[model samples]
Target: IEHSIYQIMKEDSLLYCLPKEPLQQAFRTNKLSVQGTVYGYVGWIFCQHFLERLGKEYLFLIHILDRRNPVGEEVLEKLKKRLHQDTFTREYILDIRKQYPSLLKVLYAHFLTGHYVNQAEASNQPTISYKRLTAMERLPGEDLAKRIKEVTTNYHERLVFEGFLCFNKHVLKTNLYQTTKVALSIRMDPSFLDEIEYPRDPYGLFLVYGSEFRRFHIRFSDVCRGGIRWIRSREREGQSINVR
Candidate 1:
């Protein structure tokens, strides 16, 4: 089956709420790593029935925050507080974070972290991951070690890489899950590698859906590459950024 990234996204319309400038600014600046993450944020904002809609406002704050580029400690704190209070309702953001950790990380970290405040405080904990060789190699613009670091550092690592996870509706006699690794190609540019890198960013989207069969988690990152049309392309053989 074939799916259009633009068409599928428009279904709920994550961008529908935000004014055009901030939406484009987000893509340019690489805010909220995954499209689905943005989608979830938007959905939570709409919070239908009992929910309050604040996604648009959250996006607006991000844009204004970028534009104002506040300097003073007091001013920054006040703006931050205003943003926290007006845009992201604490309960909703926390709930969404549990559901979409990576997206939230991208969004929060973008606004909060600026150069090293204290070098000694940086994380030193070891990462648990291993690399796998693939028949498919890196695309023209990507580096191998860089690619590994990108996938390993992301939210999916612990969930799928540590243990294969898939949401199956039926209970299995045993918790059976099939696993495989594909060095899937990823975007390095907005035009796309070979073509245009659709929505180019260091982190790509990886979506998991209910399925009878298990799939590599990295494959779900985006429809353009992960989607069926990508699999059908003959040129698609040598461009995965994954080790599995």
Candidate 2:
């Protein structure tokens, strides 16, 4: 079956809530990873009830088990019963295992070391680190803008890179000073490399809207440079920055 990423994510949303303790327990004892893991179907059922009683604010979390988790045969049995034969949830977890083997491997390490996976630290690690990868820090305000500019420039120059085109920055104008807004704008391109069959960033222009004196505008620039657009004018008071 052809399943979209959104569909898979919808079925898998509940898996996010599994706690570190049960995960650790299952892994430590070499039990089936899903044993202590919450049932996806149960979570789904509870969410329906919760949505009526509580609202979207309250949600459920579930965890998928692998060999690395501290789950044993008994834990797996309890989960199977709770899942109540929801093939979709089972299939989703199975897909996660196949697609993200590294996640399971990392969980195993956590089980062995009795440590919860540290997302903050792990994300911080540089893609091209010389030494062991360390936690990457949040991109600072200026740093994000600078990175976007760099990416735009590279795309302008037609560099061999991915995600460069999607990178962007918005320059905000305020009474105090000009500020920055960073966001990624990813889209598929029709052009493709003949042999490689890879899509290239298309030629497009950026149109910025908002204030200049107060620095209240979003800056737009092309990922792959060919055309450029600018509107450096301001709108009247109490009115939104016009798009031109």
Candidate 3:
């Protein structure tokens, strides 16, 4: 079943949202560290496309934030079955509270510390360090240590690594610029685009929307230094509409 789905994705040229020249150039240059935050079915579509194009030589890492919710659990189960068959792919379910306790503590403290007068003042404000917060929380029940060891032990030093992360929903605080080289945000409804602020400094941003025509449209925007350069648009029929 997964193989059939993968073949469908590979054969569907319309699913390739990125510009041909740029994508080819990225692969040719061996800049293969690609990551995104997945929300739902559209996210899965993009992941399949990436894996099909990147081939089985690249390592694919999937991070899941929630495993208890039924919808998320279903997605995880499907991903496990799909990814397990691929020898190079790996999946990690991150317990945020356990994985990032100190970071969370600092964030909590920062929010509770009080409001600053301005951006400059906020930068200079003295606050309690994360080290003084508490001890590092261990990840229990899951063999995260063994997974990490396996990743390190079997990892090739020269092979490029690619990663994918599925979040229950989009969070305003996610630092996409620092974590992912290219970030793809999926929105099933196009109406919400007006309310969201685009990221200022990501190498690439693919805003995917489900149109009323029952077609998926991708708006490619290159963001750098607080400016956006419209690249191109891709329609569900494999048509390239130049937006710039």
Query: TM-score for each prediction?
Result: 0.18, 0.16, 0.21
lDDT string, candidate 3, 39-102, tens digits: 2223323333332322332222223335567787686556554543443322221221223323
Q: Which segments of model 2 are wrong by more than 4 Å?
A: 1-88, 115-244
Q: What C-alpha lDDT does candidate 3 achieve relative to the native structure? A: 0.29
lDDT (Cα, tens digit) per residue for candidate 1, span 1-244: 1223322343223333332322243445554323324323332322211122223544455455554554544554565445435544435343433543443333223222221121112444321100101111222212322333455545323222111111111111110111121211112111111111123432332222222211222332344453432232245432221101
Q: Each candidate: what lDDT?
A: 0.29, 0.27, 0.29
- Displacement of residue 123 (Cα, Å) in model 2 is 38
Candidate 2 lDDT at 104 equals 32
Point out the worst 10-residue segment of candidate 3 by lDDT.
157-166
**Between prediction 2 and prediction 3, which has the larger TM-score?**
3
CA lDDT of 236 in candidate 2?
Answer: 63
Residue 221 lDDT in candidate 3: 50
Clash count, candidate 1: 15
